[model samples]
Target chain A: MSRKPVGNAPRREPIRTRWIWGVFAVLFVLLNPWYFPAGSSRLVGGVPLWAWVILAVCLALSVFLHFVCAVYWQTGDESDE
Target chain B: MNDSGVELAFAGASGITVLVAYGLLMLGVGVITWLANRGLHQSVDEYYLGGRGLGVMVLFFTFFATQYSGNTVVGYPPQAYRVGYAYLVSIPFFITIILAYLVFAPRLYTLGRRLSLVTPVDWIHHRFQSRALTTVAAILMLYALANYLLEQFVAIGQGVSGLTGGTIPYQVGVVFFIVIMVVYSWLGGMRSVAYTDTMQGIALLFGVIMLLVGSLMYFGTPGDAAAIMAANTPEKLAPPDGPGLLRWLSLLLLVGVGAAVYPHAVQRIFSARSEATLKRSFIRMAYMPFATAGVVFVVGIIGIAAFPGLDTAGSEQLVGRMASALANQSAIFYWAMVLLFGGVIAAIVSTADSVLLTFCSIVSHDLYGRFVNRDAAQSRQIMVGKLVGLVAVVVLVIIAWYPPATLYQIFVLKFELLIQVAPALMIGLYWTRMSRRATLAGMVIGAIFASALTLAGLRPLGLFNGLWGFLLNLAICVGGSLLLPPSMAEQNRARELTHV
Candidate 1:
């Protein structure tokens, strides 16, 4: 069994997605009531509009995570050394 | 007998029957795992980490169990009932755990696999070989985990007695399940916990979905809930004010990072069979909040329409009321509720067992093995951990029986202290310049600041006390590291240690 993870794996192009985490932080703030103050009074399909907006953003975020898990291939890469 | 008393009496009998069957099933899992891994008990790695061979499904469910405690089923709805739509923060906070994992888990998993790490403390010891640092980290984990275990004990007693209408007394319920948990854990260790957690996770998932359907059928939908709240409690339907928004954001950040760093959760990252298994598990976990917390949020929202005039304390009874009403509706719903409460008690036990196991590992492997007896046999270490875990559970059960009035105070205390470790764990992984002394200083200052602020009832600017301490913790770690740089060789070693 190989004890060294990055040592044995064949090298590939490093997937640079640190900036995507920044995007997630920004999106977190946007989904909150701070960004859509008017959503409190408004109703979307009998749910609060802010709640709907949060759900939409969460759906988008889940899709983004799915994409990241698929494509973020920096695991076991020793190129940093 | 009164009408409600008659109904509870009927439900009480059903609750006893279901709990007995559930207990048997869990014990069966214990026996099966023990039989499967009979000769391997002598090895700490096999006992504590399932030989690091969990596939994607088991890994995912074990992860699920750690993230969604009985609190998600029992505690969160009441919070939603109190805050209305604002409690939607629970969903995002759960998702943020996965986001926080994104920051560290990939690299950490790679490193842990290569090093054959067994506990979170082991990782810290590897990064900075200070005996003081390791012990402090272990003690902090034990404190938080003990608090966590106590909370589960209290919840287990209440859940059993409440669901059974005192058919099983609170003290009896706590002792009964704690005994079962200790035995199974003693027999099979992490394999038993992981197997039972998968069962409990599935049971809770089914129960939660049934709860949503049953609540909607008996009580009405969210639209009806919205209309009723508009008529009766319009303020609940309205948007949160500026202060409310700030508090929400603080909670989002606090629980996000806080829950992810939980000792058990972090250790699981080291237990995955392969990197692919770990990655797939996280992907599925990212979407679980919708089914788990999101469903419970809707249940709480529907409670506004179904049963009105509930203050926060009274709202805690909302799930019981809805489930009781469902039981009275038909035999099918009655059995369904019995299963739901059964699943709930199981969920509590599953969480408690995980906490207990992690607590033991830290004590035996980190404190005793490293500091007290460096040359102890691996089997001896496992035995010591089991005994210590049993004693701790007994002590915690006593506290649960005669719980302090400030039991709720302890519920918040663990997160505050646990999050203090985050600066060291998160920053140390990526930034090699992080000084060991600086990390220690940051933990000391942050823990003191958070605990003192909590004791004095001073949450400055309405932020959660943990957040306030975290900012200070982060500041110290950053500033202290820069001021007292490590020697050239030390810096090189630190960089080499962190490279993944």
Candidate 2:
């Protein structure tokens, strides 16, 4: 990840880059079920298999958010604190 | 709202008892917090932003309680019952809200902390130093917030009356809770609101968990419901088609961006004690959708097998009827369902209080403090804002009692205009040469265009009218910035405030 400050509030926004947003866009597309054929007749346990796929995508997005918040959200100042 | 004519079983004595207990608890917290933070009256910042001293847990729960409200519990299940698992998108939509925050929250937080922004409009005025732009954005947000509170008031009355089977009249329930809410907010301001939010969030989580457990025991598992859908209504189980995909994508964008840029949500960034406190709170919010929306999504799915062949209107009462059925099973569940109903009311009250506080803050800091009484002391400004908020609430309650036929249309237009403010807020965070004229033009035109489309009930390409307006707003903001660059001094200021 780039350590360069995107703007100067004393904090560098590494997530402001294009590739990170690209990754988010990809994950967002995967969240939709358009790729799955309509009525595939696939049911695992109780929900359709496609439904589980969507849930997994949701989980992935959340974990990614956690990673970003922990690693890249530092404000680089403590005077306010 | 209960077109299905569903009446809960434990609606009279038991429901009223829990409701009163919850109200008393919230009021007590407000008084205690007020006494502890006795210097709240010194300045607008101390009162409205809790002196920016919110820790991780209080901040986290306040964010949680504000985003998901009575509507989530009482309204979502009916949607799930109608559309089946397609409604699972609700889970991801909420998680995406965190993603939306990641886009702009870091920088916004730093700026707000450094500049001491009291409201979302404070950021706009400070950034552009333009009264025209700030007034437009504040008016739009204030209207949106007032309409939202009106909707919550209606929900409070319905939830109370539904839970009590009319033992407490609808108007009385709304007025009673509104009174309690005002007292606590008056005493402790944001601190009281966030403290009560912690209580309300816990009640909601526990109540929903019990509801889910009772549902699994009585109504059968989601898997069982899926099998029924597979046999009878396979369309409900299938993935989204072309048009469905469009709608799903639209909901994600609309909710992710619109909710993230909410004036209340933005002000929460200012309320964080430190970046670390804000970070921890956000990290927790990232996973909360699973525990809250996910559990409720399963309950809605379970409703499918339990009650079949209901019309669209009847399906809206799925949760109420399910709660009623569970209450009848035993004494334990009877109390649990009663508590669940109280939690529903608490959720609405929590939302209403936050909106009210923010509404009052904008009035005090932006309109009255900045314009009407520029030299007034902070306490005086705060008092005027409070009185105005109370008057607004009174006016809204009257509207609720005799809602106009066109009230729903007003709700849609207000929301559409609210989303139009997104372009200036998010893009202006990183863009150094963001022309204030470009932003002002974008905001004014975008709001008018969105409202016009909503009034005509037009969605040009199967997209939401709000989304269409947002896209146009962004185009104008970016394109106009390129066409008409910011003045050198404004550009220099932007670079200093934004990134290097």
Candidate 3:
């Protein structure tokens, strides 16, 4: 069985990945109702539009993240290493 | 809005029959799985991890069901209703589990492959040769997991009773699910549970979508909800202020860290066919909060306007209330509502099956296989585990019937105990200096302090959870390691192990 190399000095991933996480963090922060006036909304189809918009945004983000995960992330086989 | 007495009876019968049918089908899956893999029954690897051949989809849904079931559906909504905007942190907190996994996935996956570890306890045993520490961590995990399983069992009983208008008593509902869960889990082991989880996950997703559409058609939008809430109680719409902000941030940290270390979850990691599959599954999982948490949050917010002034118990029944209201509408809406209710039941059972399987695997693999019957054949160990699991379900079902307020207290204890293994998991992956004695000391100290603080109702000032326990747990893990010395042989072993 193979083991992780010692003193390999955790290799830093590209700054681009950090940027991606940063963007997601910020979006999540904003997507929550913390910035909006509470209990405040104009009606659209008998529901609060802002809340629906937030839900839509959240759904969109989830789908987007799923796509990215499916496409971009790769887990290399341990046997090869 | 009181319909004919006959209508009520029909609805009750329909609900109970549908739930019973679902349970029977789940049991059938378990039996079939057992027959298919009967030859492999003697191997610990095959029974616990399905020969470690679980694919991405099966692996993904299993993790999905484990994470989102009882708490996500039942526990979270009331919190959203109560706290309003602040509790939205529950969504991101879930997402954070995936983010947290990225930190150690690369190394842990490699190490897990190298060691052929079955449970997280095995990883500890491999890293730290101290049997005492290993035993303590195992006991703590078993206790926490049992409590967690009991919580799900209680939810099954409450959910059935509430959904069926109390026609079926809580005791019967608990027994029905518990028996079915045990049989299926005993037969197929992980494979049976994973297959059922995939089905349950799909059903749950469908149910949530249907409910979302139904709510939109009935109640209008968030704006409408806001108008109603504003007219009745404006406070429900306002962003959280003062302690609320602090509470939200605390929730994000507490749940994110606590949930990632769940034993069932760790076991799933070992079941993955490859590192890529695990990583891919997590990446997709990072996004699930939107469907599960976001949808549920919206439902709770809508409840603020749709059904105002419900006290705590009534509020807890928010989903059921909305479904009943929808069912009373047109024929199409009525059938759809019933399906959604059935789907919820399916989700709950799916979670119960997975938990029961994990509970059995740990007992069979760790406690019984390691201690009581070290020389027992693989088939014998599996049988012992299954028997113990059946006994556990019966006892837990009894507890579920009455259920103490301390359920939540016991529930929270799971995370604290599970997190005790984190130092070993994370540190042992990289640091060779971590002595077996020190690691053992930290786990023991962590478990005691966490349980003590929890029992004493000790919270860190304004925070909602027992972070104090964690603080001490971490301190002991890090501090004890520094104070103790690693043996020369152990050091050499660790170095050799990591020398890839």
Q: Highest TM-score: which candidate?
A: 2
Residue pairs with backbone atoms closer than 3 Å in model 2 (clashes): A7-B499, A7-B500, A8-B498, A8-B499, A8-B500, A46-B223, B11-B164
Candidate 1, residue B328: how far the Cα is off, in Å: 1.4
Assess each model's interface with DockQ, reporting 2 decimals per model: 0.37, 0.46, 0.30
Model 2 bad stretches (over 4 Å): A1-11, A78-81, B1-7
Task: State which candidate, 1 or 3, has the greater DockQ.
Answer: 1
Question: Reference contacts recovered by each candidate, as fractions?
Answer: 0.38, 0.70, 0.39
- Full ranking by TM-score: 2, 1, 3
**Tens-place lDDT digits, model 1, residues B271-351:** 788877887898999999999999999999988888888766677777887888887888877777778888899999999
- In candidate 1, clashing pairs total 0
TM-score for chain A, candidates 1 onward in order: 0.63, 0.73, 0.61
Q: Rate residue B465 of model 1 by lDDT.
A: 91
What would the per-residue lDDT of candidate 3 be over residues B160-225, giving only the tens digit for each residue?
776677788778888887778777877788898898888788878877777777787886666666
Question: Ten consecutive residues with minimal summed lDDT in candidate 1 chain B?
Answer: B1-10
Compare candidates 2 and 3 on DockQ and give the better one. 2
The CAPRI quality class of candidate 2 comes to acceptable
Candidate 1 falls in which docking quality class?
A: acceptable
Q: Of the candidates numbered 1 and 2, which has the greater DockQ value?
A: 2
